[model samples]
Target: MAIDWKGVFPAVTTKFGEDDQLDFPLFEKNLQFQLDAGVNGIILGGTLGESSVLSLEEKGTLVKFAVEKVAGKVPVILNIAEGATRDAIELARLAEEWGAKGLMMLPPMRYKSDHRETVEYFRATAKSTSLPIMIYNNPVDYKIEVTLEMFAELADLENIQAVKESTRDLTNVTRMRNLFGDRFKILCGVDTIAMEQLLMGADGWVAGLVCAFPAETVAIYKLTKTGRLAEALEIYRWFMPLLELDIHPKLVQYIKLAEERAGVGSEAVRAPRLTLIGEERERLISLIDGAIAKRPVLPEYHSIVV
Candidate 1:
């Protein structure tokens, strides 16, 4: 199936309870909310979803739940980014069987410097399933960059259909667009750089902040595509302050907190991950409130909980 890899695809948050257990019910509610808000797809287990912290079982359950809840309304792309090729392949196969539309694999973090090792890791994982694979190339998180040459090599693999170019490099996005032509789809992975990337010829955006403000993100994307830059910039300015949170170390926590403020989900997160609290929490709330105040009217789907 040719997935329409466009519009707002939110890197969803994994809701947790006070006991640090996955809140499946809350997760489903959150998923439903994003879909209702008109997201094109749901990216489960991505960085924003805190994929690294989830156990294999938790990953499987969440993928299954997201697929079931979406029910053909939107594509569910599972992040099968394991440190080893074997585990990634296994998870890829599992996700395919669980009804995921595609797989998003990141570079193996174990071998930081070897580009060949990273290439082999992705090749082996792609070989395990026929599902289309989207490379998650975020050098900031992985510490290893997938160069244009490496991306060119991966593009030859039939199932390697798309890339989530997280590095905020417009030149590289243009290079990929030049090299691959239409063979590979490039989706902007950085929320703050999305409009520029799109203008530079990126096919779609895999946004994290869209979890809180799907309507605006989707609007910006659509408007830019239609050459409505002046109107889009108006929304972009309001989004810029909130987009700053995407660069923070505790982004997942911040996004979940924003979701809570928007009444979409809880702010609770698993251990090793801390929720925003005290003055820091107050600052975030104020920022969000300020963003809300600047807008003439909030998206109809959003309701302020605090």
Candidate 2:
């Protein structure tokens, strides 16, 4: 399947069992919600999905299950965040073999590579896979910014097609549009800045909080892209407080909490990362509860299938 690489693609959360195994049934339940909400694509094992803690076998199971369950309704994309170029390449091949239609790849983990090295890493991964890649450019959390210069070096790699622009510099959207033009498709990566980025010409959204609020997320993107700023802002205003959670250190737990509140999934996180507790738990619950209390009756929003 040729990925359109445009529209809201949720970086879905990985649901886990009591033993911390891949909770396939619960995971599929969340995926069905995204698909029914009309997400353009589904990203498995990204930051929101807790890719770092998952074993290769667990990830493979997720890829195969999502590929089978999604059954081509939309492309199933696996995230690649390996620490080495060779490992990334190996996983890219494995993703293809596991029936993924595309990949959302990050730069080397732990070691922040320089510009030249970053370019080489992306290029090598691109070389190793026939599947299209969306470069995850999240300098905020990852500490490795895939700047325009690095992108220029990677311009010729035909398969290196899109960027999940999460630099948090709003001007970078305009900068990317001006510099790269259509050389790369731009998917807005930050949740809070998503509407602004779309207004600035992002082709899609690689969303985080959308895992919990799929309908509202789709509504905002659809409204913004169609020039309904007033309507979009109305929903955005209601969504802003919850959207802020996506930028926090414990976003996975926060989002999963929101998911449970939204009646989609469990707040069960893996070891070393417990569900929200104490004041932190109350704080998040307050945000989700407040939003739900005054939630907007969203306007009609069908996926803009490109």
Candidate 3:
């Protein structure tokens, strides 16, 4: 099946309550906020959603909830990454059954292994799920770098339809585009380099900032797609600092804080992940406030809360 892997898809935040439990209502509200702003799709249970911290049952609940809330209005891609391949496959199956539009899988973390193991992990996932799979290439977080050759091999699988290219290498991005071309879609995973990736021939973007700023993200993609380099570059410059927050180790905290400050979502995060505090929190807030102040106002639906 051909998938429309264009436009902005946010790794939507999983909102939590004061008790540190999943706030399904707030989570649904957050999803509605994105859809209302005209996002192409919603990505659930990804890194930004604190997928690692959620239990199997919780993950299932979250995916199911997202599917129901979206109600066929948008595509929902569930992140199915776990310490074990079996667990990941289980989640993938559940996601598909629950009506997720697609799946995003990352290499198994925790135990470092060889290229063969990485290839097997993804291959097994592709075999298990009929849903369109997007390889989430984030070597920095997973400690497993999938070589281009491995990606090419996996691209042969019919279900393996796209890749969320998080490897910050422009050369690799160019090479992937050359090798895969239109056969496998390439979506930008790094927010800071999204404009560069799209201009360089990426299909779309799986962005974290889109959780709080979908309209701007979509605008950026539309601007770049039409060859408005000057306008796109100007927006990129204003948005770059906010995107830079993802480079920090405490990215989830930074993103949630941005959402909270902007009135998009709660600042609450599950334990193992904590809310930003003291100097660090203040610094992030100050930086975002400044960005909001200096950046030009976007169009109606493109307005971000500040």
Overall lDDT per candidate, in order of appearance: 0.83, 0.91, 0.83
The clash count of every prediction, one per candidate, is 0, 0, 0
The reply for model 3, stretches above 4 Å from the true place, is 299-306
lDDT of 3 at 188: 93
Prediction 2 global C-alpha lDDT: 0.91
**Model 1 Cα shift for residue 114 (angstroms):** 1.1
TM-score of each: 0.94, 0.98, 0.94
lDDT of 1 by residue, 27-82 (tens): 88888877877777889998888887889889888888888888899889898768
Q: Which candidate is the best by lDDT?
A: 2
lDDT of 2 by residue, 1-306 (tens): 999988899999999888778788888899999988889999999988888888999999999999999998999999999999999999999999999999998999999899889999999889988999999999889999998999999999999999999999999989988998998999999998999999989999999889888999998888888888899999999899999999999999999999999988889998788888899899889889889999999877784433
TM-score of candidate 1 against the unseen true structure: 0.94
Better of 2 and 3 by TM-score: 2
Per-residue alpha-carbon lDDT of candidate 3 for residues 1-306, written as tens digits (9 for 90 to 100): 235877778998888899888898888878888888778788888889898788878877888888888888888898877778897788788888887889888888788868898899999988998898888988877778888889877877999888898988867778987777788788899998899899888878899877776667877887787776777777788888999887788888898888887777888988877788899889999998888778666644344221
Supply candidate 2's per-residue lDDT for 207: 93
Residue 59 in candidate 2 has what lDDT? 94
